[model samples]
Target: MAPAAAAAAQPAPPSLSLPPSQFARLQPHAYLLAHLSPPPSSNQPSIRANGRAPSQFRVTSANTGSLTHTNGSAVVRLGDTTAVCGVRAEILHTEDIASWSVSRPTPASSSPTGNKRRKLTDSTAKLSAESENKEEDGDDESQIQDFSLLVPNLSLSTGCAPGFIPGAPPSALAQSLSHQILTLLHSTRLVRAEDLRIWYQPPNLGPEELERHNENEQMDVDAPQGEVDLEKNKEIKAFWVLYIDIMIISLAGNPFDAAWAAVLAALRDTKLARAWWDVDNEMVVCSDAVSEARKLSLRGLPISSTFCVFEADAASGWRAVVIPDAEEEKELDDSTRKGIQRRWVLADPDGYEEGLSQERICVVVDKEQDGKGKTVIMKLEKNGGWAVDTKELKTLVDISAQRWEDLKQILEQC
Candidate 1:
């Protein structure tokens, strides 16, 4: 048999499938090698393809408190890549089946068991009393409502990514990124749901009764002016909804960094409206007379950091270029550049690096420690690459700890 014929007869190997984020990590290594091998032009020494010195970072500027009406807003820029985050607080209804409290009042019109109430009084009084109870029920039902933190509905229309189009469904990438940010927030318990519970003096009222009361109040509003049922529209007692919209305005390499930075900036400036519950009146109040806007409590800020690896030589057993400190990055020599790969770790990376990194590792850390004062929550592997040994992993943790402390100090001033 001819060699060509035999080779053609062989079955093709099965293709390997990896997550999209892994694809992003593998993207940079190939292109970065070409740029790294060539000596940087002396004329444009300051401009690296990645747009940062070996030890330097992309220019970072944060403009906070930008939205005039929003509770909080921020816009962050790293070079040409920019992210804007706005936090709008809205009161909504809570559907959580948990937290049913006994002893809470039911509307006089609502049945004791939460069913429809039958008229019991004489015919003439029945009509009068029924109308009155309907009014009362509408006034008292909303004891608590859900609060939502949403990304702008208009953002999708502005063309954030190639996959995103006006009036189109969210692509898989959009869903995944949104999930990531929400998971991170939930894992860290950054926003305490219980904290939102509006405590009332001499408290007591049942959920069923509250709804009935609200129903009655709706009937009383004058035909001309629609009435807002404060009880029915009360802000949720607990839990929060965070909708993150990451606009990939530029598919620059480090979406994680940009997304996280946007998240932090938005959170830093975020605030909520204050609400008070009056136990005596058995109702929630949200008005100028009893309510005021307040900032959300942000304790021990958390930061996510990323690093890019380049120019790897698998045959020679070269692992990666560790940009652990400033000195090493400053002393990058030809041998260092050729023999070892280069890694730029910081809050954000530009388009060049995003397109050409070998592998990327991102670590999230909190500023405060636990009983042992250890703030490191969890180390996540987003884009898969060379498996880091236990020792190297610890080094990553140590670096993250230091970075966390530094950022915490920076936030204090802000």
Candidate 2:
């Protein structure tokens, strides 16, 4: 064959471009190298894409009462991330409240003889009667059911990010995020349970007494109508239940902080309608009168701040760890003698920054009265294999306190 024909017959060289998966694996490293390294034009390091310092947060804004139909609603934005929270109020029955109590199933008896011998006896009946008496007399001590039920849910759809699918089952990330929000709400005790309680006077007359009273009233034409009606009695029944739903419109990063802020704003704006028991209908009635409505009692405003931890390169005034071969043992010894590896903590990390981070810490803080007045940490969540020092943790908490104050002021304005 001719030389040209032989050359053309040879297999084409492997494509220079990497496969999508391989490129994704290296993208974070590439981003870190480009952003952390000093710029060629200037000796100083390059600024982040949004021109923000490592420790600075993006601009934040909040608005409340945007959804008229909901009991309360709020939209919070931190840079490009946006979250909307809506609170809906509903009536809760006493039986439903009883079911909310945590219960554990008793294990079956392991021994066959014990199971066969188990039977109700006179003593068991006596014990049951005593328990019933205690319940009727309210002698048994138990936790008071003062607070209303709160249910929080989080949604992450395709519009919120690129990877999420539309109309698909909730991903693990969405469920985990919802669980974290609910945990914080309960642990922090931001909403007072007593504020959600609804009280009314139930009727005291039995069926026979009611029938006789109605007949007497009908027969007594000379009696003053208003005076006779004023002698009736009333009783309290149940309370309100709040359903909090949060949606992520855009997820740049640090969703936990944004979602929490939205929740706080919505809850602060919530107002419960007036409710009363109707003896005639045998049901609870809610008044539509706005004048009778009351705002929810908020215990304390808690705010959160998130930080991403990145491994700093040795050139950035920090030691870097690496396994050494026989020939490189001397370099490893020198690095160890110099110092331990150091990490860089970045605040309010965006999506790209989070991709490069190996660890994350979320700190929640609130102002409380503990010896006059003081700032207290409400919750702290750290994820990753990295361990943080005590001093560093303290510093992070202090920063969270400052952020809390700033966010509190913004929420008040909203």
Candidate 3:
């Protein structure tokens, strides 16, 4: 036989020597396709690459009080995603509180009775002003925590992910996530407002006398100091402001859930340094004693659950079977089956799964019931192209409630 004829008769051997780097690059795509595609036998359910059920979440772990300088700190890991949160408290005066409150002008309304004589009292006008301010704030309505501020900031660094760059100004994604976190904290009212209030005590002497005494104390180190009267300054005039910072240590998708979890853990562990006004020194003093510090009054623990929505592929045998015309059905091959248009919800999607998902929903729920004794949905955020129905949203809420209990137990352990 001729060499060419012999080579043609023998089939080409399989290519089994692909380079590791090339395989690594193609592995994700291949894996995704495999999961989306149905099994040859048509008896298996379409499973995640990690073998988890569609609605199942990845393993989660949390640790608190990790940073020494921060008043409270926590690190949360959900699968490969990692978020660290730190909370620092500061003192805010009455003027500072007023500045944080939005300023707005009140509108004059026409009298119901034409030319009716009506006099507006000072209290009524003040109430009207506050109502106008609240209206102007709209969805970004600020919560008055004894007029204290709670600022939450999120940072995504280059080390966290491949796309992020170091030294870059805050990205749009970071800003949006920070805003959402702040909104959730405020709306949930997790930290009690009254807990932030710092009462003011009047100085033993008048303002002028107190100034002179302060000067004298500064001038003469050997001079005997007067005892501070803690009971005198009982008027509320200041507050403890909290500054919450969240850092993304790693990016593996579902950052919102991880960040919120870290925030909850950190805030739960926060303790404020004991502060008192020193009438003799004419200044506010914080105690260095750890025993003097007080724990923050946390209202309720709210946990967040996130889900990613992907379009279901009917051709993937896991979906509903399609009925073709009687004649065509018998002749149809596996590849010839067309995919149906449907959506699938995946809970706690990792980076790879998130990449293929189009829509995302984050639900924040608290175990506490409102005055009406119903579970509170602290926050419900949905973004992307797909829409969820009422029934689906209700199911998500139920899932969130379950997650809340699980997370609460974890936090309690921390």
Clash counts for all predictions: 30, 7, 3
RMSD (CA, Å), candidate 2 to true, equals 14.0
Model 2 steric clash pairs: 147-193, 200-235, 200-236, 201-234, 201-235, 202-234, 202-235
Worst 10 residues of 2 by lDDT: 136-145
lDDT tens digits by residue: candidate 2, 1-414? 699999999999999987645764676554454454433344454345446766778899999999999999999999999999999998875546554344211222323322332454788767756765555333111212233367899998577888887678898877998999987877776665556655564344564665566665442233333333323332225657789999999999989899999999999999988887776887788888999999987877888999988665655442344435645645555325333333557789999788878789999888874655488888888888565777888988888888887898899899
Q: What is the alpha-carbon lDDT for the whole of candidate 2?
A: 0.72
- Which candidate has the highest lDDT of all? 3
User: What TM-score should be assigned to candidate 3?
Assistant: 0.71
Two-way TM-score contest, 2 vs 3, winner: 3
Candidate 2 Cα deviation (angstroms), residue 231: 19
Question: Which of the numbered candidates is closest to the native, going by highest TM-score?
Answer: 3
Global lDDT scores for all candidate models: 0.52, 0.72, 0.73
lDDT: which is higher, 2 or 3?
3
Candidate 1 segments whose C-alpha is farther than 4 A from its true place: 1-31, 38-48, 51-56, 93-168, 203-251, 278-283, 289-292, 311-348, 369-375, 405-414
TM-scores for the candidates: 0.57, 0.68, 0.71
